[model samples]
Target: MNENLFAPFITPSIMGITTLPIIIMFPCLILSTPKRWIPNRIQTLQMWLIRLITKQMMTMHNKLGRTWTLMLMSLILFIASTNLLGLLPYSFTPTTQLSMNIGMAIPLWMGTVLMGFRNKPKASLAHFLPQGTPTPLIPMLIIIETISLFIQPLALAVRLTANITAGHLLIHLIGSATLALSSISMTVSSITFMILFLLTILEFAVAMIQAYVFTLLVSLYLHDNS
Candidate 1:
């Protein structure tokens, strides 16, 4: 069965770009929480869930220090799995949509802004502009940094959307061409199918790589703010 198109698989629902951010975030939220409040009923369920996640992470960090080996591996696996799942024949790649990538970037960008403001209330403005710049240079630097802040989310969204959409379109075009030719001769079509199959596998690899890159950039942003 093409699960990608079936009842539980629901291609249209699963294949949009808007879904990735929520999916990726559910886990990240769990990971970022504190431990002590998990048992408190008055606390929101979201809080408890996050606390449980942070507890485990805290344990790991205590044992392993600040090494990102685990976080990196988890991010790669999670994103790769979702991406590859979309590559199945007749399935849609959510990554191909700009909305999904934007969804993913929005939270990250917001987090960066909030963390900068919350952690360094007085320094948030200075963080972007830096200190000790001459009055004449301040306007130029602020303009540049402001532009950069806006571009960060846009760039993140566009990069993933372009890569995934282009890959899928190329794959589908090739498959369609091969299918038309196959009607004329099985031998040529078979070879083309095999080539296309190999390319599909390559697409799986690309999905994982893209996801990793996206997550890594996000982490870097978080680290910078922290």
Candidate 2:
């Protein structure tokens, strides 16, 4: 496999096509679902777990529907797992590459905007352009709203790209430093190694958090627009 850090970003077509795995992974759940009225023990357990979590959240508040939440959960798990996988030595961080992450973010942003507009055609415009603006400011408001609408995908792309890239770079730098220093001074380099080891845990947390943030923001976008 190509180990070049920047190569994937340069040729987007290669990384751009990676979204297929995510789609294929999630959509395949439908096939595993039982068609008959009766479900096996494992399937029943999964359904119960989903329902239990759904009910608990619904009891607190009803902002997000169960079905959407389930989809969001799947997205979170997929992203988190992919990110963690990339953290392993020599593995490519798909999320670290702008092309891959942006490819994913763009579709997500497009889906959210398309669904929101379809669900609320009138309010879609109004959501972008608020209702209380005076006639004189309508054009200005429209321009602002248009800019804001356009920035959604851009924001998603930059956010994921920056987070993952920074993280991977930090890990690489620390590991390299530890490697270089370990030969001359074991004590100092060991400390650095320990810190880098701790950083892996932090990276794990960040990976999970980024995944949740992405899904949560997507959900909020859908909820607000819907």
Candidate 3:
């Protein structure tokens, strides 16, 4: 049972085909390209959402970081889509894997740090040493600061992985309990199903929020460096 529960997280190696791409395409497949002169429901909703998301991502990035709207938007969309799709029956959540999260985080985080170093060398270096520090504690402070600096990417990766994994695990356990209770007591099973339904809804919200948070953190990192 535990193996079946975690089987989705395991990587697959297939010579013929894989369901991963199809699942990833699910989000894009639902919305069509706006072709009509007067936008329909999906088009209108997409346009409005585009404006809202762009504003959220770009408003604070008025400086050199303004150009990153596309990249950040793509990141958010990818994470959100993967998360939401995983809610469906038999679907897998790639973001739940620590390796993939770390892969996404390190390069972006490194880019921000490199940008800061390139543009503001002294400022980047200054992060390692506090102003007006005691001479004796300087070494200790530098070590602490350096450690903190390097921990940023790991923190981002673990944060997203932890939240998504926990939410899915909860949903899975509750769903199993609902099925198991059906034979014992119809009343209890109904109650459990209701709770499971509410939890699923909450997980849906969590999926989007975590994606937003991950992208927003990346944006903040970029803003600081820019």
Best by lDDT: 3
* Candidate 2 residue lDDT tens string, 141-190: 88988998888877877897789778887887788789989999999999
Better of 2 and 3 by TM-score: 3
Question: In model 3, which range of ten residues has the least summed lDDT?
Answer: 1-10
Please report, in order, the local distance difference test score of every candidate based on alpha carbons. 0.66, 0.71, 0.87
Candidate 1 residues lying further than 4 Å off, grouped into runs, are 1-78, 121-127, 130-135, 184-191
lDDT of 3 by residue, 1-226 (tens): 2548776676554775765666566676665678879988878986787689989788987577988888888788889988998899977888898988999999999999999999889988998898999999999999999999899999999999999999998888888899999999999999999999999999999999999999999998998888
- In the range 140-212, model 1's lDDT, one tens digit per residue, is 9999988898798899889877777767776877787698888999999998999888988888788877876
Higher-scoring candidate on lDDT, 1 or 3: 3
Candidate 2 weakest lDDT stretch, 10 residues = 57-66
- The TM-score of candidate 2 is 0.73
Predicted structure with the largest TM-score when compared to the true one: 3
* Backbone collisions counted per model: 3, 0, 0
Q: What TM-score, over all chains together, does every model reach?
A: 0.62, 0.73, 0.91
TM-score, predicted candidate 3 vs. hidden true structure: 0.91
